[model samples]
Target: MARFVAGYFRSGRIPIRGVHLAVVLTFSLLAVTAHAEFPLPNHGESVIVGGDRAYPPYEFIDKDGKPAGYNVDLTKAIAEVMGIRVEFRFGSWSEMRTALQKKKIDILQGISYSEDRSRTLDFSPPHTIVHHAIFARRETRPVRTLEELRGKKVIVFRDGIMHERLKRMGFDRELILTPTPAEALRLLASGKYDYAVVAMLPGMYLIRELHLSNLVPVAKAVVSEQYCYGVLKGNRELLSRFSEGLAILIKTGQYKEIYNKWLGVNEPPRVTKELAIKYGAAILVPLLVILAVTVLWSRTLHKRVEARTAELAQEVAERNRALEELRRHQDKLIQADKMASLGTLVSGVAHEINNPNGLLLLDIPILKRVHDDADEIFEDRFREHGDFMLGGVPYSEMRAEIPRILQEMQDGAQRIKRIVNDLKDFARRDDAGQKELIDVNAAVQTALRLIDPTIRSSTQHFAATYAEGLPPVLGNAQRIEQVVVNLVLNACQALPGVDRGVSLATGFDREQNVVVIQVRDEGVGIAGEHLPQLMDPFFTTKRDTGGTGLGLSVSAGIVKEHGGTLRFESAPETGTTVTLSLPVPAQRG
Candidate 1:
């Protein structure tokens, strides 16, 4: 029967009539069904078939706790054709592969054929073709090809064929490996990832079972792989038998039935003139009746539309007025929010400056008194040396102390000046619209100086490391400083004690053509629940400590405006590292 069917297919002699095709299929099925009692191979009476239980619709544990799916059924059918008993073992993909290598499992179903695997194993003729698809949010633009996904945050099953394929295609940098496609799709739906590369059938099954409505297949399959049963390299007889059984299954239309049951089949509709005419006649009277009624209703609808149009115009005008009012309120709210944030920063700066101001105030009067007394002594000239010792100190000691006092006052004044300058730079709104080529190392230093007071107030050790020969970044210096200040301030706040340390580092990312600034803190770290919302506007973990939650959000915005990315990696008890990556302008040299 298998030989006859193969001959027919090879002859390209498909029956043109539906009845003839049905008869041929029925005979082929019967012939293959009779061969179900064929003798098993001498070496093994029962074969062990292994598959990944996580792969749905192909091989997975059903609700009945029994191994089930298309591959399971297909393997069973093939085993029956070869008159062999089958024992199914289910595990992870890697575990199953190891089992196959160890000879614990005689065959592995639902495995994609690869040249590397062919070295140690013999693959049966492919029973089915698996197509890989890119799944992403429905709102995202469709990514039809692999090239379109360059640098996209993609998720794929770890060690799966798609993962290897992506790595081979030079997308290893962007992949976020997951243990299964379901997890990958879930992450994609949650916006943690930009795309998921997975087999279409299993991906669709998971989306339906999990009810992930936000995601959809981006486009047609980006890759198609042949799935076949694998046997040990020396098991030539078993490989041959499995191939023959699979061919018989196909010839008898059993394979097609299984394929359709699991992954839906798309059949073209047969449109004959007679059938179309018959169906057309059946609806022709109703169509004419509806048309006549529609003509009459059109006149009434036109009158109603005129009235409705006038009403809609009035409603639109009211809506416009409401929208304008809303916009005014929004603007006011935004301004208020900005002012509140600015007020908080100003308060911190004021507290920092107050200490220096107080020192200057106390020392200025004492220094002036000493100077006056010394002038009087000098004018007398004939006065004894004791006269110059107004503060009970020798004249030489007084002269040295006076210079030291003036220097202290000057340093204090300079400290105040630097604070005010940093404040002025931070508060400049015009910096957002301006771009300039500035040294990133200088920016980091300035930010460190501004935040040094905050860092010193805590017992946290602070350190800065700047890489030599770093290229300048194209951005507003003040804006970059703002980002660094926010990150450092957040790091300081996260530290629970003086034993922890915060480090700021700057270097060039030569491959990506960007300047990287990293702020790492050995602090309490962020909670997992808060990581997703870490950059959300008004989302704060330090609300009790006067945190506006706008620090990270505003910082992220500033970085983005400068064509850069702000990312954070944090784990509880492991501390956090926030990285600011800003693109470097093209070098003239």
Candidate 2:
């Protein structure tokens, strides 16, 4: 909603009008000025009262778009007691105050009674007692003494009674200000302002309504001011009538009843600024100095944090360098393990071929003797009985049978030789070696041999359970061996201090076309929470005991390379079982 105000500019200096003057000017000029204070007509019908609509629990808008509050109800009660009809007018506090001053409203409800105000307006006798006190955050003690506040920042409502009291007490006038008590207290409670002094009744209501725990009353009512009705000065008849009505209410105890209804059961401690300064100075000054010191200390700590951050960055760089070196070493180990596996396979193939090659060598001489005897017989027949031998039918059949037998032996030797050549090519780890189908079981066994010495020396015992007739797996043999070896060595480490054995088991899942290997330990089990982080590189529980934390990560990488998965399950009181599953070779079309 855009609110507009009217004021004519003259010679670059805008002239201001009083509340009533603006109303009259608007009527004559046929203009509507939002700031103008129009009369809330009495009409010998209703007693009119004006209040700050934004002020809560005194006079403000309610959910139904109607005026409501203690003051609103009190005014109606006062009118009922006086046998008069009543009407309410709502506006901002500044506008309401101006309206009251302009004789536009007969009364201003919720006015705090003060002596200085009496000179300009007639005040009804005090209707209620509301103590005034200071509030601060729980983290900050309330300002109980004037001396306690000497060097601290305090807040007060502009032109409020507290401001006057502070001035009278010779307080330094540099405190912060807000337009209303609520704003000042709000700022104080939020730590934006150090302290605020408000009427105890309003403060209590605010604290409860705002659900503010940190705000509390500390100082004694500088003066226990009363809440009274304020009438414009020179309105004696109206003023007298209000006072008489108030007296009747008071005499009937209705006023006290109303006061108690809103403010009973709240009896805050009584503390005066004089008492505060006398007993609180010794405690207050030291705390203030400590707070100052703490602030400085925190700033110094921030600088140290920056320095530590730089140190951490340097450490990260050094760690990266070390990780690169470790990666290179792991690559070398993979290559070496591959070569070792290849060498074993080649040696096995050579032994297999040696038997067939020796058999062929022994059969060759007999085969040659048969051929020579036949050739001599043929030559003699050609020289003497060639025609007769040509006529002999069974002799050609025998020669044909002998040659066929020799050819069969030669073919058998050739097949064995070809198989041996294939083994050599497969085992070669030179630059020209290509990926090929491999026996996963053989790879696993070879890896066991390579890491067996390390496992035996590091742990208590070892065992193997391998399943036969496993299908071939497609992978780099060396990489797969490295993976197995690292897994075995890690299992061995987990079994430290345990006299029990570590078991390495391998099998195949026919349906899934995958080979599964599990390495289990009867050593100490991994804690549940620590299991999740075991494969995270550089995260080790054995920092003090010599663990690099990289072995598991590397093993996991190798399994992934072979289209495989590595997983584990462990319990705190039991043992850990690490399983690796590699896919079997894909079928050829």
Candidate 3:
């Protein structure tokens, strides 16, 4: 018999090892002697066992929809040995508990031990032990203990031992009770809950059955629960019968057979120190040889890795130097772009200043003439009868002419002030990069004023249309002004002669919820081929005219940065219209 048992173990059919075989053999001998004269209970009818209908592997409806599983199989084996027939009643766990409590069912299988339940139910000796574990998304850190689940969204089966345990542990604030462990795990897999508390075997089984790839069991078991059958309190006879039958099943090896069939082979029993010592020398001899060989191999590999790491470090340094040189070249290009924009504005500014300066020069000669006339009048008054007309003209006429010349000079100075203010605003540095609610119409008007001189010199008719009650746009005011100025300057340059016209308009695009600014010019229009490349950096149709090609490109970039668009529409000899559509600020009550 000893030789046969050793052969059975070595075949790997049973996972048991070491001292466990002795325990099983001892119990088997006791079971034969104890069963010799054991009396069977006399129940008038079939024993009715109650279990959850949906729970799998333990108790559930099978493919043919009949009640089945480990608990069912165990119950049938116990009944067969006790010389009685058994029936199964499948329902919700709550219903099963109610039926068992009301004496409607003689047995309740797959129930965990609980203090409250002991008051109304008599539990049999535990048939199986289940370890409770935390189930969470695979990407989440493993929750090794119950305390780690605190402050996280935890789902548990309603009325289950896990729910009661969490409540006792003061985790009620984070607990979400579901109808079943399957439901709780489903919620956890869907990311609706952070973790689920459930038995390890059932959770793993359900995860595979449901094909929930995201859910995984944490490595550490939180608690272990003994699952047993229950009967009504004071039904000591039925509970005693169940215990004896279960003992018979275990002693006969039927319990282990059923467990292996449903849950897979049990892990090998722990090795004893005597068993370890018996095999110690066999294991240690090869391990020492491997260790010595590994040490020599590791030394060689370490030197190779050191050499490779040094090569990688040198390569990294070279790449960084190349990147630094590229950055410096890019900075030069940006500076050149800025100088080009400044050069384009300088000509328009000079023309604007010249007009005001000319008016100031004209006022100088008028002042001189007024002085000469006043001097003549005073001389004539002194020479002739003390009230003589000045240079054969009336003093009233001289006074009127003096006031008119002074008013003209004042007007000219005001015009010069406006032109200088516009230029300063355009040239102001916007380093802060702050954005605020801006009036698009106001920005359009400022651009028109700044570019007025260039427009007059390049085109005959210039018109501006402003829409009232337009919605405000959120952007950097200075940047928006720059975009408008670039567009208008481009339009002025596009005009072929003074007969061409330019128009600037501002309005709200209600459908798109944006503020629209349009600058149209009747000039030598752009060709279709050039239109696509108009916004490309360093691309321009006016290259021969000293265009640096950054105006449209830079303007388009600015518009995009402000969450807006700069689009163009043009036909040969017809006109070119550049439209800017900027998002409006969300209204606040």
Residue 345 displacement (Å), model 1: 84
Badly placed stretches (over 4 Å) of model 3 are 1-44, 266-589
Best by lDDT: 1
User: Which residue runs of candidate 2 sit more than 4 Å off their true CA positions?
Assistant: 1-44, 54-60, 146-151, 167-172, 265-589
Q: How would you encode candidate 1's per-residue C-alpha lDDT over 311-407 as one tens digit per residue?
A: 6667787665555565456544554455445544555555665676667767777877787776666646535533232232224334444555566
Candidate 2's TM-score: 0.37
**Which one wins by TM-score: 2 or 3?**
3
In the range 1-589, model 2's lDDT, one tens digit per residue, is 0001121211112222122232232232222212224333365777778876655555677789899876777777778887777789987666777888876777887776555666676555445545666677877765555446655677876655667656655675657867766777778777795777777666777788777888777765544544566776655456445555666665577755665564444546444444557554764475456556655665575566557656766778766565556545654454455445545645665666677687786787677787878777775775674322121122433344455557756775665565455345434443312567888778889998887678778766678888988888877888788778877777777774657678988899889789999988876788888877886545677766556555665566567667888888888657789888988877889
- In lDDT terms, how accurate is model 2? 0.64
Residue 351's lDDT within candidate 2 is 68
**Residue lDDT tens for model 3, 1-589:** 2223333333433322222343344334333333313233356677788988867778788889898888999888888898777788998777887787677888787887766667676566566656677888988988677877778999988767788878977898999987777788888888897889887777877888889989987743466555777776656565566666777787798877887788653222334545556665564465456545555555565556556556666879766565556545654555444544553454356466667567776776677678777766665666675432232223433434454546656675665554444444433343327888888888888777887788778878988899999988888887888888888888889888888888888888888998899889998898988888888766888867657666676676678778898889997888899989999878789
Give the candidates in order of TM-score, highest first. Answer: 3, 1, 2
Cα misplacement distance, residue 580 of candidate 1 (Å): 91
Give the Cα-based TM-score of candidate 3 against the true structure.
Answer: 0.40
